[model samples]
Target: MEFRYLGNSGLKISEIIYGNWLTHGSQVENDTATECVHAALDAGITTFDTADAYANTVAEQVLGDALKNQRRASLEIFTKVYWPTGPKGHNDVGLSRKHILESIDGSLQRLGTDYVDLYQAHRYDHETPLEETMQAFADVVRSGKALYIGVSEWTADQLRAGHALAKELNVQLISNQPQYSMLWRVIEKQVVPTSGELGISQIVWSPVAQGVLTGKYRPGQQAPEGSRAADTKGGADAIRGFLRDEVLTAVQGLQPIADELGITMAQLAVAWVLQNQNVSGAIVGASRPEQVRSNAAAAGIRLSGDIMGRIDEAVGDVAQTDPALTASPARRPA
Candidate 1:
């Protein structure tokens, strides 16, 4: 696998970051999760991204157990805060000083690590003052609980303000984690440019559009059993919008492109995101070990300008490009 510098920092992360969002503690068994993690390591993925909110905090414990034997220095671990975790208590959410400080300790304990390579805000907390949030992050970095800081799904304006405050407090805001893929281009218009100027890189998730870009879901047909859209817990909800006939047809139109490149649809999807110079990494999750290996093959693959144009023409306007579509919750969960 290939590696790239994360933002302007000295840190380098695997281009394909192994992430556990919906599978680890909720959809798949612990043994299965362990196998996937091992597969990622075997595939040369040194970066792992998770969140405290995933599976109500069980995901971190599962990932910790999976990587308990690896040399800690060999990995780049990332986790996030700002979502309601642990029984969803009144004080358990947002980026307030109390929440930020306490969440780091809890995450460290759960992940079985004293410090994480990166800590992130899961979303923009509209209810909390930005100053309070950035200062808390600064303390997190100063105390050595985390090496660098980042935010996910934040607007461009929000990133500018947060980056300015991070500079004032003397901390590094090096990355932005956003939902970016061939089907999701909302970040390209504004966030990409702003982050570029501020010396930040994007670690994009859902590079396969939650499996929609894998050419598994077809137009006017029942979703194949066991697909993400067929999942009932929360997967269906996450991928429902992309299951529209127009979107499915548009996605299927890329089959010829994938065939011509001698790559799978999933690889094409992941490589497509990495083609953007500002993207530092593309996050991929898996239920099976082979899936990890397959997605990892896209790490160093480069698409020419002509292929990119053809892909755009194939997907047409069905892809979501409206900048407004990239958004975070208006308020922290109660």
Candidate 2:
């Protein structure tokens, strides 16, 4: 597996980070989840990313059990806060000092680790003061609960302000996790430029556009049985936007490109995301062990300039590139 430093930090992570967003503790059985984790380790993936809100915290428990016997020092485990993990009390959410302080301990307990390598804010809390949020993160680092800080799905302006505060507090703000794929190019315009300037690398999720780029959902066809689009508990709503005939047909056009390179459409999609210099890792989720093995092959493949141009020509018109689409909702459930 190829590795890269997350942002300007000296810490290195695998190019393909194994993530359990929708499969662990919800869609898949515990044994299946454990098998997938083992497969990732066998494929030389050392980085694992999960969030407190995933599967109502059961994802972390399953992931923790999967990694319990492994040498802790050799792995880079990341988790996030800022979502309602429990009862809907005011203190149960947001990036307030109270929530941050409480959330880290719960996360540590669920993860079966004393500290996470990277602790991220799942989203920018519009209701909380930025200072309070930054100070809470700084406190998390000082307390040795997290080695570094990151944010997910934050706008460029939010990132800049948070980064400034992190610098002032002497905290290492190293990465940003966002939804990035051939179909979603919102980050390229502003977030990437701001993050590049601030020395923050992107650990992008949905590099295959929530399985849409795999070309499994053909145009004008009902989604295959048990696929993401058919599994309501596993990202069905999120994948709905990309289920249009035009998008599916456009994705189909990339099959020949993948055939030419002797790669699966999923591998082509993942390799496409890693081509960006600012992307530290692409997060991939799986329900089966073989899926992990197949996607890991994209770690070292590099696309030529002509292939990239061909990819752009194939899906550019259907891609979502509006910077305005990058903003988070003012009020999430948390």
Candidate 1 per-residue C-alpha lDDT over 1-334 given as tens digits, one digit per residue, 9 for 90 to 100: 9999999899999999999999999888999999999999999999999999999999999999999989999999999999999978888999999999999999999999999999999999999999999999999999999999999998999999999999999899999999998888999999999999999999999999999999999899999999888888788999988889999999989999999999999999999999999999999999999999999999899999999999999999988889998788887777
lDDT of 2 by residue, 1-334 (tens): 9999999899999999999999998889999999999999999999999998999889999999999989999999999998888775878878889988998999999989999999999998988999999999999999999999999999999999999999999999999999999999999999999999999999999999989999999998998998999998857987999999999999999999999999999999999999999999999999899999999989999999999999999996999998888876697564
- Every model: Cα RMSD to truth: 0.6, 0.8
- In the predicted model 2, the residue pairs found to clash are none
So what's the TM-score on candidate 2?
0.99
Q: lDDT for every model?
A: 0.95, 0.94
Which consecutive 10 residues in model 1 have the weakest lDDT in total? 325-334
